[model samples]
Target: MKVVIAGGHGKIAMLLHPILEEKGHTVKGLIRKEEQADDLRKAGAEPVVVDLEKEDDISEYVGEADAVVFAAGAGPGSGKERKWSVDRDGATKLMEAAKKNDIERYVMISAMGLETPRGDDVFQVYQQAKLQADKALRNSGLNYVIIKPGRLTNDEGTGKVKIAEKLDRGEIPREDVARVIAEILEDDTIEDVEFDLLSGDDEIKVALQEFV
Candidate 1:
């Protein structure tokens, strides 16, 4: 399968690239900066430089991929405006590109607890943007999976996870999240599912099997 990921230079995307490649899937990452191209190449993905914020049409960038992943974000340091552009509008464009390119599978890296309100100022805007984007994908009539994880950590992954339609608020490592995405991409059986995730005693594949 061929996969295209938005925010290809992101922490999770970097971790995910080699995993997908090892599984024999071709990967392409869409990045905003020319410098980030080398980093993506090192991670075993073809890097395409395209600023999601400036570009209106992205079908050419997504070209001939089996799946698309929206891992892009407007980072915590970014102001509220970028939350709308990168988090919301950026994701919207990816969906459009996927449809135009006839890509059926989409996996969204969304935030947990978006239905409830939290945070002050910019954080709130971020939540709203993600929620809107998730809604758009659900309505897009595409085979989609929305992985909404709790507080993310940089700790080592245990290769275990607890996944459900809605899991209690908890934390999981970024490595584990990347592994989960790789597994989801390889298995076409998992479709139109949205779940919250956290570290747990169950094996990742087994836990996902229960929900997907």
Candidate 2:
């Protein structure tokens, strides 16, 4: 399998690259900066320079991939406009590229509790943007999975997670989220599934069994 990850320099994406490579999958990472290419290469992923916000057409880069993963974000330091551009518009554009290339499998690294209001003004707008992106994916007619994880921490992964259509608010390590993404990619049985993910006692593969 060939997997292309947007925002390949991201914490979760970097961690995920090795897992897919170890499983015999070719990994391509989309990065905006040329300097970030070396980091992705060290992690065993081929790097492609493509700025999601500026690129009008990305099918040339994403075409022929088995799947595409949207791991891009505008970051907390960025303003509200960038939130809509990178998070919302970036995701939609990837969907369009996927359709143009006839790639159906997609995994979205979305945030949890999009329906609830908890953050400040800017964060609220971020939530709204994610909500809109998720809506588009549901209507996109693509085989997709939306993994909405709670507050992300930098702690080491426990290799356990609680997954459900709706899960209470909680936190999970970035490593765990990367592991889950790799798991979902390998299992074709998981399709059109949207879930809230959090740290839990259940094993990753076993916890996912119920969803399948």
Task: Point to the candidate with the largest lDDT.
Answer: 1
Clashing pairs in 2: none
Task: Give residue 199's error in model 2 in angstroms.
Answer: 0.5
Q: Model 2: per-residue lDDT, tens digit, 1-212?
A: 99999889999999999999999999999999999999999999999999998988888977688899999999898889988999999999999999999998999999899999777888988999999999999999999999999999999999999999888889999999999999999998999989999999999999998766
Candidates in order have lDDT scores of: 0.94, 0.93
Tens digit per residue, CA lDDT, model 1, 1-212 = 99999999998999999999998999999999999999999999999999999999989988999999999999989999999999999999999999998999999999889989888979999999999999999999889999999999999899999998887889999999999999999889999999999998888889989886
TM for candidate 2 is 0.98
Q: What is the RMSD, in Å, between candidate 1 and the native fold over all Cα?
A: 0.7
TM-score, every prediction: 0.98, 0.98
Assess the local accuracy of residue 41 in candidate 2 as a C-alpha lDDT between 0 and 100: 95
| Model 1 misplaced regions, further than 4 Å | none
